[model samples]
Target: MRKLLLLILLAAGFLSVRAQDVSLTKGWKLAIGDSAQWASPTYNDQHWQAVNVAQSWEQEGHPGYDGFGWYRIHVVIPSSLKQNAFLKDSLRINLGSVDDNDEVYLNGKLIGRFGGKTGDIKTGSFYGPRTYTIAANNPAILWDKENVLAVRIFDTGGDGGIYGTNFSIGMADVMDHVTVNTEADFNYGERNSLSKSIKLITTNHYDYKGKLAFKVTDPETKAVLYEKTNDAAFSVGRPFTYSFEIARLEKKSYTIVYTFTDEKSGKEITHTETTPYLLTPYPSAKPKINGADVFGARPDHPFLYLIPATGQKPLTYKAQGLPDGLKLDAATGIITGAVAQKGSYPVTLTVSNRLGSKTKSFTIIIGDKIGLTPALGWNSWNAWGLSVDDKKVRISAKAMVDRLSAHGWAYINIDDGWEAEQRQADGKIIANSKFPDMKALTDYVHGLGLRMGIYSSPGPRTCGGFLGSWQHEDQDAQTYGDWGIDYLKYDWCSYSEVTPANPDLPALKKPYQVMRSSLDKINRDIMYSLCQYGWGKVWEWGAEVGGNSWRTTGDIQDTWRSLSSIGFNQDKAAPFSQPGHFNDPDMLVVGKVGWGPSLHNTRLTYDEQYTHISLWSLLSSPLLIGCDMGHLDRFTLNLLTNDEVLAIDQDALGKGASQYLKKEDYQIWVKELKDGGKAIGLFNLSDKYQTISLDKNDPALKGYTKFRDVWQQKYVITTGKDFSAKVAPHGVMLIRVEK
Candidate 1:
């Protein structure tokens, strides 16, 4: 019976394994041409040039060169590497991320491939991290000896080469080593839930006779409030979970950490998660108006505005002292009409719920200026990347209307990947199959009282290698105008190809000038946005080129470094901010943003998210939501619906915030408001809770003594000349002060 069972199990093919990786960031020879001999181990590569694989070859000394390239390297494989108690029998190859296409080889044998030639079926293998298994013990590995690894790459256009951080050989799934889902294991948003869960999952064949330790620390004082340890054993992909009630813990955020020690491997892995509590309080159930108090429109153009209000359901809206030809839909709180006259009109907008009623003084300025305040809307880039489609866009539009329209969200902008592969015979650009009907889509959004936006580039191809305006600027602009595109994000992706070698400022301005002229010829107003990544001090010349907003930096990631570096460094461009013109530091990454169809919650901690929204508002930067609107969470919604916080960004004065005080990682930035008040952001850039204070003598808080916590919407009492608070790590104290 035992022998029969053994035979049954053997035939079933069962083996549990885990993998660790060896980073191959160095030692590579690159050449421009591809030959079959290059894949062989015996090929002499001494004459091949050494190159950095982190970026494209164009950025690595070879400029404007795009085509086939060969990368080769050699490394010795340790014989004992496979001997790891839990490691898989076969080695897994990771080529990192490659542009276009790639086929990797080991000892002259093709092991794995990506992109079109591989028949991947999946279109984004080149964009995501790739792992290919050697399928059990393969002779091509040549263990305990030097082995050659070669990569053949095919590039069509734009950026090309083998790039990304991870390039190595591992075993099985890298996550099999350890993956801690902190949010899933804990009651992060449930304040009344006393039970706390902690999970330890590993799929290794070896039973980790490991010790797992859990602890909670006071972030401010570094005091350990709870501590426990358990001798745990786990195998066969089952998660070892530990749960306990933390009713003893306080309401504020505390640092929770878990450490796992594998006795055999002697590996110590620590996972830390912060802010398992909610800070942004829920808005009042009673009626309250929010968002920009001021609105703008072009003379006699189709006018629409949603009275932004937050409260319980069944809210009523009314507008008084309105200009002629405008009507309000009390049922939907949407005002739609076209005013022939161009002037400033003050209207009192009121919203009432069962609990109470709130009124706000609103202004409508119909003149040449548009985008009077930094745009508050959504863009498709972060959530869906190049995979965005018409269906996804429609879903986003409906979501914005249902959940976010009441809080002043507008503009359903499609970024990249919407253009047809080929333009029309008449030189007019058209939407791709993904967006079957661009005109109808615009009408759908406009009918919902929301504006529609489109994207293009000054080059022949966009960043996603789609059709751009290029030399046919007039035709493309005319096409967009005919479709009633309200905004245009003109990227400078492949436009560099047309620029002169070591081009001067004039050459840089030429493409934008061409597009601006083309837009001017159109019959309607389309907000021109410059997406040049803030190179060469664009703020000084952006308005002159007819740009409503210009990018001040490269793309923003969800990491703290990306957020701070891009947001805090906008002071140089602050002086140039004004009505109808603003500095853009990229879109908001506060929600789930994966740059593709697969979305993940932002890596920013809860505190970091507050800092992100606060600093962006202070900078007067365009607030473009780059998340999947269909996946709106309560916490993310609250973070966005804070009327007091958003009012700073929409201030009519349009003066950007300046860094008034900087102390290492602690900073205080202040922006002037249109109402003789100042919006102040006291940011703690450090990793620890810090006592951030403002002195009356410092002048940033001089006569601005009647202070109110804008985020909390409560006035505070302070004595003497100092105002202080123990701000959380990567958090901020947003306040509005007046004399």
Candidate 2:
């Protein structure tokens, strides 16, 4: 009986030891100014502002002050507690959130410091809470009697405070520990109810020296599924990444628990994360065409479409079953093969990624060939600048359709500044006196067998200070659709007010999505062109946003200098253009006489103008003549109506143009056609006529022993390894060769 009583007493003593409490709510003193006297132990802080230990001084009434401030707290260690207890050595002081920067010290010994200025709207900054550790070597930081913990904070601007509420002095074991951040949150790709391999990433930030063990278990059933451990050593401030491939997971929710220990301190940290393991069946690996219509498919040509996978990094795509000689571009998803052997063929495509793979298939029924080249067009911006009006547009449309329709020009576009002052009500669009009848004008253009294009901005004001489509996307789209507008050019200028200078994808996505959805609902077939001047990688998602074309460079002016600058910029965007969508280098500036306070001011010479047209044609840009058709001189008419010059721009083979040779003042451009022929352009950018020579060994001239000068209508044969000729300043020599 006496032994039993002794056992009960021992149990009581153990319970008491476990229930012991430590109070961290004590005296905190603060000092201001340049005096270091507060560091002395004898200095009295009784007269200083008294406050709670874990509180924001700024919230309590410190005003008009944002700079360096000092905070000190005195903590007492109970005599009953042993100096070497693990609990006493594992204490930490968390200072929530500090503006700009901070440093912590225990009894004049620095513990830890984080330095940086507050975040501006442009750059991100220190957010959330910060923590500092108290090691065993500095036990005096919280001594047996009185101890002082000091903190120095610096605030440059904005609200200076320890943001968010909870601040405490607690034992490290009492707080949740994270040895590694949660990595594998959900299964990659499509989720299903089948067992599959799962990959996870583990990051180790703590200074730990031991094996890290990971285990997955069904939280509800308490059944362990997978377990693995790795021998990893991590130093403080250094992060290490570890990947684990675990298999045999079904469609169920599971909890992952990971644990690690410090070899020297014998301290262990454990983390738990929960995620769902889905087992959805994989999608079929066959090509499925989208965006095509119900008309019977043709052997020679048929419109085929497919929506590329969204949210994945862009991919290179290759397709088969196109007419024999044509080749498809895998990187751009463009079908570029020539339909030489006319017969129906089944089309199939396979898309693969690092994670997995997918496939799509369709039928291409070939028939008698129909020409699929883009329609030749004319835009008024090059001819009239901001002076385009109803009378000018109507007369030009009639003249172009009457004179150039037989030569393949089919679109007449009215560029910027078509809106009137009455539309200024509520800053929305309304046609003015110049366009008294919008529908009549559209009909007038259509009556001449031509399509009509108009322009506006995505913001509240256009570049010409006219009404834009900011808050009126749907209204403006409906208005344009009602007026029978065939194409719309949406520019981005005042839109920057709502769009931050450098914004993340999410911030810029909503505005673009709104405009796209509105246009699609208004008229799905309406051609939409986006003009954002190449900002925000708009080309990456321009097609998804309902854009048929997008401006990839700044505005082009009527000069060889401006034209060449824009021409070079087009090279970077070559990879993004496809059959329906294109990269626009602004409008053509061939006939504009200059705008700003100048009359009939011809900026580009006749040779420069020829070079501009030659480059644009070879580049396969939209053929929008900016020259005024009603007032065209004989020279301008001859340049615009040359059938041989138009053939290069209307090439059927859809291949990107290339620059074969480039010097300080000259360049050679060429495009290859599927018919074993080529179009070559030689340009001289200097002020004086210069002798130009072509090397037969160059890739551009390799297949050509003889060529016809299209403009001169004369055939020339090469005599030796090089052909030399004198070209006028800013002159271009356009030639067609049959290999």
Reference-based lDDT, residue 256, model 1:
75
Question: 1-739, model 1: which lDDT tens digit per residue?
Answer: 0000010111111112224455567888898877889999999999998987776676687654545798999988776667663545667666654655678889999987766533641222233345567764788988778999998886544345776555766555333446454544244424444456767766455666689888878888899878999887667677787776665555456777888787876766677766445445677899988878788888777677878888998999999988997999997788988888999999999999889889999999988888899888999988888888999889999999888877788888999889888988888899888988999999898778788888988887776767878999999888888887888999887676677654578877889999999988876768888987776688999998889999887567677876887788888999999999999989999777777766667878778888899999999999989898888776688788777788899888999999998789899999999999899999999989888898876777777768888877788788877988778998888999988
Off by over 4 Å in 1: 1-178, 182-215, 225-251, 258-270, 354-356
Q: Which runs in model 2 stand beyond 4 Å of their true positions?
A: 1-375, 420-429, 504-513, 537-541, 596-601
- TM-score of every candidate relative to the true structure: 0.81, 0.49
Candidates in order: C-alpha RMSD to true structure: 7.4, 30.1
Model 1 steric clash pairs: none
Model 2, position 247, has a per-residue lDDT of: 56
Worst 10 residues of 2 by lDDT: 1-10
Q: Rate the local accuracy (lDDT) of all candidates.
A: 0.78, 0.57
